[model samples]
Every structure is written in C-alpha cells, then in structure tokens.
Target: MTSQTLLSHVASILDAAGVKRGAIHDVHTNTHLLRHEVTTNLDATVYRPLFCLILQGAKEVGTSAKLLKVRAGQSLIVSHALPVVSRITEASPDRPYIALVFPLDLDLLRSLAPAVMPTFDKAASDPFSIFRRDMDEGLEDALLRYFVQCKAKNTRHLLAPITAREIHARLLIGRHADVLLRLLWHDSAASRINEATREIQSNLSETIVVGDLAQRIGMSSSAFFEQFKAITGTSPLQYQKDLRLLRARDALRATRAKVSDIALRVGYESSAQFSREYSRKFGKSPRQDRNIAPVEQQQCIADPAPR
Candidate 1:
C-alpha cells in the first residue's frame, strides 16, 4: 500500500477512536494514540522501550548525545528506557501530527530469540537505544492489523496479542533486527544497561551505588559506567536523579502532598535543593508548577515529538 493510503487508514482509526489532542491511552494495554494540533516545546520524559510510527507531520527527539528526526513513513524504535527531550516540529489543524506507540514486550522478544539467532551476527556492535528507520511494508501491515484489532472489541482480546507479537517479529527480522537482537541478547551492552536502569528505577528513593550496580550486572565499574552512558545518554546517578524528580513532579500534580514531603519521598533530603533542581530541569519551581491547571501540567508531561 502507498504511504498516503496507509496514513489514511490510520487516521480513520484514530478519528473513530476519538483520540484527543495529547497522549490518549488506547484499549490495548501499552498502546497510545498521540495527536497534537500545533507544534510543541521540547519536553523531557522517560521513553520506555517502544515503537512509534508517525502517520502525519514530524517530530524531533534527542538525548544529550544525538538528535533524531522522525516524520511520516518513518518509525522510531527505543530499545531501552531513556530520558529524552523532544518537540513537535510540524503540525496544524488541517493535518495534525498523529502517531501510535506501543511498549516492547521483552519477555516475548526473548521467547522468539532462539529462532532468530542465526539471522544476526553475534559480535555486532550495539546500536543506539533510540534510532529511526524507514517503515517497511510488512511492519506496516502488522501495525495496520494491530490498529484494526484494537478497535474491534470482540476480537481485540484474541487477536491483539497475536498481532502484537507479529509486529515484534517483523521488527526483529526487519531493518532494525540488529538493534533489537543486541537489546534482547543476554549479557550484551544493551541488556546490561537495561538491567542497571531497572535497578535505579526500583530503588529510585534510595541511594544508588553505581559500582555495586555494575557488579550485579556483571560489568566492571568503568565498563558499566561507560556502557550505561552510551545506551542511556546520561550517567547512572543522573538517570536516577531524573527519575526521582519526574516522580516528584507526578506526585505534586496528582496529590496535595507538600513539596518538602514529596522531595523527601523522592530521595531528596533538602526541600531547597529539590526546588532548585526541579526548577532547572522543568523551568518552574515545584510550587509554581503545581499551581498550573492539571490539564496544562499533563500537557507538559506528554512525550516529546520526534525531531
């Protein structure tokens, strides 16, 4: 199918699904429909391992190390959780930017690993955790089927999982196969970095010992630190700090907790320090940000559009 035809199909599904002007969680677990009528400022957020397909317009996403521009007919794959800054570069009411995102199922990917092992070079260098590629017909077909299944209440439960798996399979065998394989392979740089990320996430409020984390993940401290930064585009401590502040921001918006209490809960011992860091990261003090309307705060939290 032509790119425009495929986009038309996706647009129809999005319109029927009534996705609003922001991230709208769809019926399928881990799936979201993102739409925006105007360009957006660069926003920071943790992008979990997922695939994003842009149907119209364009977006820019970047870490401290690299920037990626993903437009229509292109797909962006994030192989690991990473904090990123992104913004919408193109959009309008006439043809607002629309995209679909779904989390990667690592366990499922692992289950399919054995069969696909021979197709990849075992010693290939790891690709960036976040990368973009042109969408292929097979992947597009899988996504189209998945989108259709998402809207079919009766068949969704039965078919969505199957189609989701197929989508991952297509990715594994397609142009991104090298990146996906390295990520899924045990003891690889991507997997080790992913482990470290999980450790930090689980202990967000606690002090993270980078050396201990490195040892636990079977890497020397120096090697682990380098790989962690390579994959995540930030140091281990910085990653943990970002997660803490982001969680604090979420708490500040969702509840009436005091700023100091929220700061303490997120591992910050001093409210004053927390406020300074939060303001620097988000361009607003905790209290000032909390004062914004909830809807506006949510908009601030939306995923950055790919560059």
Candidate 2:
C-alpha cells in the first residue's frame, strides 16, 4: 500500500477499536479521537501525559493567560498539569478532526537515551515544558502503526513497548527535542520543576508549601518559583489548584458522593470556594457539570488555540 493509504488504514484501525471519545487504555494504548467537530465546552478528569497529533482541522487550548493553536498536521504536547480552556477551531461535517494521543513515559526516555546519539544543546538548556510541533509523514506513519498494533491485544503484548520507543526516538529528532531533553537533565530547571510537580500531583489534597518543595528540589524560593513558571507556564500554586480541580472532576464522575465532599477531598477548605474556582476553570460549576467529556477536549483546553 502507498504511504498515505497505510496511514488511512491505521486511522481506521484505531477508530474501529478504541472507545468513541474519552476513554482510557492500559500503559500501552490509552485514547484516540476519531475525526469529528465538537461545539460544546468541556473539562477532563485525568491530566494525560501524552502528545496530541492532529491529522486534520484546528484546535485552541487556553489557560489563564496562555492560548495556543494547533492546526492540521500539527500536534501539541502539554508536559504539566494545567487548568485550561479549549475550543475546536477547525472541523467540518465531511472531514472531521482526526487526532491521536501517545502517552509519554519518563522511564522509557531514560532507558532509550543511552542507545540514541545525544543531539541536545546543553548551553541552551531550558526546563521541559509544554511543546508544539508539526509531525512529518514518517512520524505520523509510525504513530498510526503503533495504534494499530495496540488495537490488537496479542500484538500489543509484544510490540507496544517497541513502538513506543520508536515514537520517542522520532520525538528526540523532531522539532521539540529541547523541551523534552531538558526534562531529563539533572540540573535543569525543567527537571527540578517536574520533580516538584510530581510531589504535588501525588499529594493534591495537602496544603502545599512551595518553599518546602523548592528546598526539596534544591532551589531557593525565588529561583524555584521562576523555574517552575518557566517550565510549567504557570505558578506552582496554580499548578496545585489545577491538580485539585482535576481530581475533583474524577470524583464527580466516578462516585455518587456529594460535590462538597469531592471538593474537600481535592483540598478545598470550603465547598463554595471549590465551586467558584471550578466554575471559573470549566465555565460551569462542578455540581452543574457531572460528566467528563472526551480526553482530547479536556487536554486541548489548557493549550484553546493550538500554538
């Protein structure tokens, strides 16, 4: 088959297999977005650590101040947790937007780095933050085949990790290596900020002391705040709040618990406060919006227009 024909086949395989919209998969293959245009606004529960490949159409993702646009053949990567506003900018009835998200694995990056030639610029080091790029045909083909393999249970057991490695290798040589390479550097701000981010992500309900996290990452309060913003595109406090809101969203959908209880569980001292923030973040109160939308919609919200 021709290359374009192969890509089309891969897209078909993925759409035929996975959940329609917002669904989760195992470590191997998690989510897929079939070609479609959406008009509604939505929020997601889980903050996906993945890359979004847009086969067609356009999307916009926004945070408090940052708005990014992703167009056809391009993709956006969100490296950190964020409260976002996303809107579909391009789609039609005939040719809906086709997108795929590949989850990132820190462990895999560490494992594969030794085998690949280092092509990073140490002097231009920056923290691994969110990134955007246009995918080449080869990378797109690899991703399509990876998803197709993932759809087959038998093949996924053996090929998922291998295909995942190929994806990462392509990323290293693709347009946004600096952001990811910085994520792995020991002394880079991105690495420290990511380390701090992990601590907050795991402890979303706790009252985080940015100073303590700064100390843990060996950065002073001032330096830590600056580095954190540099890597994550937002302040540490905002990051914590975003994590709490996301967990609260999960709680909203997964259980029959009260909204107040869910809010408190996600670190809100007052239900009223949580509702207000949730409304601001999602454009609707937590009580008003009960269901989680597709993962793509939720993820793209943080970046509204693709950058």
Candidate 3:
C-alpha cells in the first residue's frame, strides 16, 4: 500500500544483509534481493516462474518481441521459462534500484487451484506469459509480513511456510489470478504452451519437429505455432535456441569443460557456429565468457540458487 514505508523496510533488511549490488540469496526467507547503484547495459538471461517486486528505481525487461518496464511499487510475474534481454534504466547511489524475486511453485499453486473459484474467461486474453502492473496492496502486505516473520528465528521455520501458502492463495484471488488460473487448467492455450516449453527444456539436444510436437500435444502445427508465439513471445525454434545458449553460458561460467564440448552438450553441431551465436547473444565468445565466468556467475536471473 504505502510504498515508502514498505520500501524503507525492504531497504533496511537489504542493507543489513550487505547487499550493495547484484543479487543476494536470503536463505532464511527463500527469496532474493537485487540492487544496482547505477543504470546498466542490456543483459540476457533465462527467467523462471517467479514474481519480482520492484522496491526502488526501475528496469526494462523483454523478450525479442515484447518489453515491459517496472518502477518502484510495481511487480512483474514471469509465468514460464523465458530468455529475456533487460537493462536497468534507473538507479543511483542514493536511490539504488532494488527488487525482490520470489520463485513461484507451480505444484503449490496447482494444489490451491481447486479451492479458488474460476474466473469467467477460459484463458486470459492477453497471450503473453508475463504480467506487470502496480503492486497489489493485499499481496504487498502479506509479503512484508512474511519478510518480518523471517527475521525471528522461532517463526521463520514454524510460521513462514503458512505465510508462504497465504501468498499463493492471494495470487489466486488477486489481480494475478487470471493468468495463473489459465495455467491451472489442463487444456488452456497457456497451459499447452507451458507443456511445450517443458518438452523443449527436457530435450534441448534433440531436434524439434514442430508438427510432431503439436500433434503430441493435441494441436495442429499451425495452431501450435501461433499460440506458442502468442504466449512465449518467441517462435518455438528460437525459444530452444535461446535456451541452449543460456545453458551453455551457465556451463562456461561453472565448469572447465572444453568450449566445443560444452557446445555439443547443448546440441550444437558446430563449435564455430555455437561461438558465433553465443557472441551474438551475449556479446562474447565462448572462451571469452569462460575467462570471465567467475565474476559473471552472480546476477539477477531466474534461479540464483540453481539446483
């Protein structure tokens, strides 16, 4: 509700936690804190299911075809795994950009779906899987309370999960309910697109046959293609390509595997081709990225705490 009070509370916790820039994983709260002292350049990464609450400043995030901006007191929900290009458009030492990312648990949300009354729309008319708007006051209050409760050791374990459940329940009944409820249904376009994304994710190395995929999912190729782009903002092939490159980047950052080997692991037939696409996507060659991988490992991404 009152943005200033909540913002100040979040800022203080981040300050005490020593988050100067980049992202901080709050193990105690199972959330992440991101701060930037100045605006930044265009960056790319894969986003998972999560909601980011912008507490201060602003940022622009988008896929190849869509862009959305978030300022203080706003929130963004990413409902699927997406490769996104983003930039920090607002920040400074005195008023650093701050945001909190909380991962969405589909299983938990699915469980709560039965209790939630259905919306009139079969699926959200808005085809895109991402949503951004002014923060919901009730949701904001619940999150702030969750944060406060995490500070006390006794309640962090005993009561925090209850609040976490409340947070999901609020999402079901809140303004975010439409898109989420769409995903909850087994046969909605959004849900089908979500299934398609998982298939691609599970077999990144295997070549995709769009028609086969469409048939497997019970949709015609033309229909699948159109709905896929509508929901994901990228073509099916492009989605797989982006995901492969992102996974390769993660490998470059965390391992000493040969660049060519890493490329092959991600389904690239030619190491040279992989390098070219990698350079284009990330502005650096594979070896070059590996050279700077150590420092590059930490940033605002879908899953900071990767499995």
Candidate 4:
C-alpha cells in the first residue's frame, strides 16, 4: 500500500477508537494515540523504547542538542528510555495532529534477532536512541493490519500480537537496524546505558554512585559517563534527578501528602532544595502545581512506563 493510503487507514482507526485531543492510552498493550487540535508548547517527558508513526500533521521532538521533525509518512523509533521535549507543530480542529505509539518489546525483538538478516556493518560509534526514517510499505502495511485487528471484536486478541510481531520484525531490518541490534548486544554502548538506566530507576529513592554504576556496567567511569550522556542527552546524575522530580510531581498530584513528605520520599534531604529545583524543572512550585487539576497538568510531562 502507498504511504497516503496507510495513513488514511490509521486515521480512520484513530477516529473509530475515539481518542481525545491529548494523549490517550489504547486498549492494546503498550499502545497510545496522540491528537491535538492546535499547536502546543514544548512538553518534557521521558519517551521509553517505542515506535511512533505519524499519520497526520507533524511534531518536533528534541533533547538538549538533538531535534527531530516527524511528519506524516514518516516514523520515529526510540530504542532507549530518554528524556525529551516534544510539541505538536501542525494541527487544526478540522484535521488534528494524529499519531500512534507502540512501546518496543525487547524480549520479542531478541527472540527474532537470529532470524533477522544482517543488512548493515557495525558502526564505530553508537547512534542516538531516537531515529526518524521514511515509512516503508512493509512497515506501513503491518501497522495498518495491526490497527485493523485492533478494531475487530473477535480477531483482535489473536491477530494483534501477530501483527505487532511483524511490525517489530520489519523495524529490525529497516534503516535503524544497527541501532536496534546494538541495543540487544551485551557489550554495546546502547545496551550498557539501558542497563544503567534501569538500575537507577529501580533505586530512585536511594543515592546513585556513578562510579559504581559504571563498574557494574563493565566500563571505566569516564567511558561510561561519556557514553551515557551521548545516548541519553543528560548526565547520569541529571537523569536521576529528572526521574526523582517527575515522581515527586506525580505524587503531589495523586495524593494528599505534604510537599516535604513527597520530597523526602523521592530522596531529597532538603525540602527547600526540592521546591527550588521542582519549580526550575516544571515552571511552578509543587504546591502551586498540585493545586491545578491533574488533567490540566497532565500534558506538560511524560510518564515513563515501569521497567
């Protein structure tokens, strides 16, 4: 099928699914729909390993130095958990920005790795986690079939998983195959950084020792620090800080806990320090942010899926 035709099918599925003007979680596991009627300010969030296909409109996603514009007929693959700022760049009430996201299943990818034909030489340097490429007919067709099965009542359960696997297989052999392959290899930079991030996430409430983490990942401190920053666009400490603040924000919105209690819960020794950094990262103090309804604040941040 052509790119335009594939997009049409996806747009139809999104309309039938009835996603709202913001991010909506789909019934299928690890799938989400994003829609917006107007352009939005840059919103910070941790984009986990996922594939994002834009069916209509466009979006800009970036970190400190890297920015990617993903438009209709294009796809973006994020192979690791990275914090990014993203915004809808084009949209209208009549034709809203529409996109679909599916979190990558690493185990499934690994299971299919041996069967994948090697199509590229190993790169001397690791590529960034985020990749944008033209949507191929094979990938597009797989995505269309996935969405079609998603809408079907009786066939969805059996067919969706099969289609999801095909989509992954297509990506495994696509343009960013090397990056995805490196992520699966034990000694590759992407794999090591991914492991480190998971360790930090698992112990967010405790102190993180960069040297120890590097040692655990089988790299010198300097090497690990450099590669981690290169892949994630932030230092390890800064990444952990971002996660802590995000968790605190979620806590403030979800519970009646005091700001100080939340701060301590997320490993901040000083509540004053927490409030200062929280305001710097998010635009308002914790109390002020929490006063706003959860739905209103939801669009400003990205929630990382549990490891």
TM-score of each: 0.90, 0.82, 0.94, 0.91
Cα lDDT, all candidates: 0.78, 0.66, 0.83, 0.79
Candidate 4 runs further than 4 Å off: 5-20, 28-30, 117-120, 124-126, 293-307
Q: On a 0 to 100 scale, what is the lDDT of residue 6 in model 2?
A: 39
Q: RMSD per prediction, one decimal? A: 3.7, 4.6, 2.2, 2.6
Please give, for residues 1-307, the per-residue lDDT of candidate 3 as tens digits: 4567667766887788787777777788788788889888877888888888899999998896899998988888888788788888999999999888888888999998888745537835686888887888888988888888888999998888999999989988888887788877888888888898889998999999999999988999999999999888999999999999988988888889999999999999999999999999888888887866322123445463321
Winner on lDDT between 2 and 4 is 4
Q: Rank the candidates by TM-score, best first.
A: 3, 4, 1, 2
Minimal lDDT window, size 10, model 2: 298-307
Which should have the higher TM-score, number 2 or number 3? 3
lDDT of 2 at 68: 74
Please, what are the lDDT tens digits per residue for candidate 4 over residues 125-211?
Answer: 646788888888888878777877877766688888888888888888886687788788766788889999989888888998999
In model 3, the clashing pairs are: none
Q: Rank the candidates by lDDT, best first.
A: 3, 4, 1, 2
